[model samples]
Target: MDVREIPHTEATEATEATEATEATQATGAAHAAAADATAAALARVRGAARAGHPRALAWRTERLTALRALLTERQDDLAAALHSDLRKPRSEVDNAEVGFTLREIDHALRHLPGWLAPEPVAAAALGRLPPGAAATTRYEPLGTVLVIGPWNFPVQLLLVPVVGALAAGNTVVVKPSELAPATSALFASLLPAYLGADTVAVVEGGPEETAALLAERFDHVFYTGNGTVGRAVMRAAAAHLTPVTLELGGKCPVFVDRDVDLAAVAARLARAKFANAGQTCVAPDHVLTDPGTGRRLTAELARAVEERFGPDPAASEHYGRIVNEHHFDRLVALLDSGRVVLGGRHDRADRYLAPTVLANVAPDAPAMREEVFGPILPVVHVAGVDEAIALVNGGDRPLALYAFTGDEAARRRLADETRSGAVNFGLPFAHLGVPELPFGGVGESGFGAYHGHHSFAAFSHRRARLDVPIGAA
Candidate 1:
């Protein structure tokens, strides 16, 4: 019989099956190509590192300067890509991603000379040596390293580490997050042009490409994401005995004292929590306050949200959408876990979730179960600072702990009692802007910190050198 003579349903099924098979084959081929490209890039970067091309101060300076220029020259391009990926506002893209990275590059460039200088060891510390003996510690590059970036704040999170790696005079292979495909493609295309193809290579793909890159040996692996993948990165690095710096996120908590300025506290909290659609690593995941304070703060927070995003945030130009449908759905479900006090509207089609505040949230609510990396802010009532401290101590250490209080004793108590990566007295997410502070997590958040001088240290090996006369030893 002729193929046209077949039943309509049967023919449709046959065609669909054939298309599926073809798609599967194509996907396999693409993954294979990505793996091959990653392997080749690693080899090229390693070769460059061995050639000592990146070790020169001049070369490092040129790369840093180029990185800054790239950010400045392509600010609009980056902002557009970020908007495509996360619906990020242009102002946020400028201030948070491009501007943040530019600051890092500038700091590294300005301090590179002083940071690279060898530190002399005291004679008292060098025991059992000749009188003329001297010791010094030099900051040396860790050779070709791999930097795996996260989708949230893709440019800043990924390139900030690159600044340190390059500043430390290391050839680098960067793996941009596949979720942010626009930014990833942009980086893949632009990095080679700006930083040279041989010294710095950008590998673009998802888990497959990352797995392939992880399988290969690297001097150091720097990852910024969650703990699940952070563990995987650690495991892969273990095979090669490679050191890794994991910048992972957890449920950061905030405590609102009844004595503080409710309006100011609410404003800061709203700004920090809702920014980037609440996808920030250090954003306040939940609020702990007394029942009265919770009720009052909820009203203030509602006012703050309206003031920031206007009556209808969905219509606001400054408001952002969720990264994707999965996160959107996850956040939508959390809204049911507590009483919605403010914005709770969401549209899956647009991946938009309003800056929602959940009051009367039970401690064991679904939203409280994990890090709510969305625009859902859960407010749980506590007895006071003691209860807040207890709750914070009970859970895994957070990446940041925020408190709004005028009492010095309360501030000191929170600072002294909590085991977090950072503690802010009256605000949240400000510590990251300070280039001098080390930014990372503790416990489940992840290990290893990086920023400014800390970034240089993370990528460098303090090689100890000893000098003595021929017979002095």
Candidate 2:
């Protein structure tokens, strides 16, 4: 039929109906394809697990060694992939992504034997057992597990957990974030070569593919991203009674006391907050301080930003662009929430946002309404430490709480009073580097924790074993 010859409304309706039908068909096909891919990946990993391929300490060590090789041998390839996806500088690629994962692997390799060892329970602790009886707790793998990565810090966050899963003697299905396409592709292409295609598989796609993957049962599902999607993953996991470890983000707060080195504080805060163009999950979301300290610190922060990025941050090689336009626009809108004391410039085509600082931001300001996962830093004036603590206590618990104060009393107060995943005194985000410390959030941020020994524990089932002499008792 010639649509031009037909009535305008009728022609338009007919075209719309046809377009809608085609769209529905395309969506269905995509889902079907995703299901097929997921099924194949799961089957491979499950087969490996069932065959007890991953149960051997030697097998686990070999896989870990291969992962280390991937990081070390392909350092340039990984750096280039990360730069393509995030515009991440080579130094950051080394320090945060490649080197970070390498360190995690090294730690796991060094400690895997001890982590897997069974612990004997004393007879007295067991309340007196029969002669020749023994009791112990053994760490066992949870079989095939799924790891879902976030776009930010794609390499480290995704592989670090996988290191733990493998160290604990389990096969893994890795889902690298589709947002970081280059890195994702790199993982899909390289992981098979290094870790083998059967046990550790990389599945790449957006939410649809993820949903398809979640439909199948897994021993464990570890997701790192926002809370909204974390809830959805939990719901899907519930279908099969599958366990999940959600590493989510929230508005991490920074509290500045009246007495302290404001310049030093500003310098540290600027480094921590503006790194990765402030897309960090543990970045300071807002600054809470007295009006006097807020004024002085704001000025110091301006100086720090200038010193770090020079006159124009957009031209600085070390400075990063927003991950995408959506985040850039969201960060741009936040500039209006308060007076822009520093760095309000942006270029949409380049996806560049200067390290922005907003002063006199009210409690109800738009920027304070949610997790500002960008280069925008908001300074909220408060009466004092007490008021700041009250304000923080009143809201949903943050992932991290930072206080730069020499006053031991104030520091203790913040540490004792605040309900957060972690408390940092004098600096922010440093705890993440310490592998001994458990990294995860409470309340809205996240539930499960993982890092170092904690990672091995997260993917392991600690079973209690008891052997008694039936005749001896």
Candidate 3:
């Protein structure tokens, strides 16, 4: 299908129509059937919050273990589905989505009990006035959580938080992105089969179904995607006062210091930057390298592009498509903003853009101003490290900030001065592998973290209790 940008009026109506259709088609049956199914599950969540039930928590954990097993057995199938939906290659999918989150589930399963254990807190002096008292902090599940996954990596985004909610002992209602319709349907079909339909349900639809879902009260909400839709999700979530974890995207910046290895940097950065066709939330949207070094980095990246994507990505199948032409055109427009140093070829039919590198670009150029999610790299030359930091911080807060430097001092300074969802010193995208590290964004990028303890925390609430037998006070 030739991709035409939907005008606001049409897009709004279409989204509404899709939502209405989804509610009428899927949600009606789901809501009617849920009276018995989710009620008891929801009661467990409530009891977990008020009375703190160990058995209920254990049951949720057991369900998680079973689901993790299902996720593990179907790794290849999940990877293939992701590939079919987003054109993600197997290796990248393994490294980025499948292996990463699967490993996360394994880690969570092994330690979830310890995490759920009530934390002991030192008692205040009031307790010691007559007798010493010990305090324990309780972690309880939010009754029901709404998780909205994005199209970029539908499975991981959806499953990752599901892991967290399960660990925290909450029932989840997942709304996968309609953009990746096949994966959405596959997930809807497979989840109910692998796990019970009552515990975890998938309501697949576009905006209106989402609006209705958002209209209802959820104890917590998790969303992953662009800032625009993120705002809408946040707005809807606000109506219910539902606490949300927004995992949105922004223009993640890469600062290449003058004192670094060009070839090694190219190898590491090229892999991270272009993986998944640069649609990654933390992918380097633009590069800020030192004077002359920017040009050198650009040239090196251009060479790396050829090394990575070959002379002609249009004819290559190893490289993935633009997912859709809307993104294809957005990337092509960035190409027009600057001098193309390396590759600039677009085949709309295939949704292919040659691993493109643009240079001599103004700082405010569309190539620099926007988040170039395709295989496009823009190089901006700066006078010094200060200028680079200024350039980086000048933009809205980004999800990820990458600084490449052998100078430990510069690296630390960059870390201190720059604020993002996460910061990496070297070896690009290394944070993705940190099992303990939380992945998320700040300001416009996103609001919450996932992958480790961060995920569990996002799905659960900390409720303080004054249980001094009602007399100690």
- Candidate 2, residues 1-473, lDDT tens digits: the string is 79889899999999999999999999999878867876887788899999987888999999999999999999999889888888987888899888888888999999888888889997687667767888999889999999999998999999999999999889999999999999999999899889988869888888877888899889999999999999999999999999999999999999888888999999999999988889889999999998899889988998998898888888888888789988888889888999998888899999999898899899999998899999999999998889999989988898999988888888888988889999998889998889899999998999899989999999999999998887875
Task: Report the C-alpha lDDT of model 3 over 1-473, residue by residue, as the tens digit.
Answer: 21248887788888899889988988678766654454454444345544443237567667776777777787788777877777777776776676767787788878887888888666663455344455667778777787889888887778888888878877777889988887888888777677666567787777866776777678898988888888888898888888988887788888888888897888778888778777878888888876688777876776777787777765554567778888888888889778898778788987777777788778988887777877888888777678878887888899888888888887888888888888888866688778688888889888878877888888877766443443544
lDDT of each: 0.91, 0.90, 0.77
RMSD of each: 2.2, 2.9, 7.6
Looking at model 2, residue 204 earns an lDDT score of 89
Say which prediction, candidate 1 or candidate 2, comes out ahead on lDDT: 1
What's each prediction's TM-score? 0.95, 0.94, 0.86
lDDT of 1 by residue, 1-473 (tens): 66588799988888899899999999899878877876777778889899988888999999999988889999889989998998898888988899899989989999999998989998798688877888999999999999999999999999999999999999999999999999999999999899888778999877877897899889999999989999999999999999999888888999998898999998999899999999999999999999899999999998999999999999988888888888888889899899998889888999989999999999889999999998999999999889999999999999999998888999999999989999998879899989899998999998899999999899999999998878764
Look at candidate 1 and tell me the lDDT of residue 234.
95
Report the alpha-carbon TM-score of model 2 versus the true structure.
0.94
Candidate 2's C-alpha runs over 4 A off are: 1-34
Clashing pairs in 2: none
Q: By summed lDDT, which 10 consecutive residues of candidate 2 come out lowest?
A: 122-131
Clash-forming residue pairs, model 1: none
Best by TM-score: 1
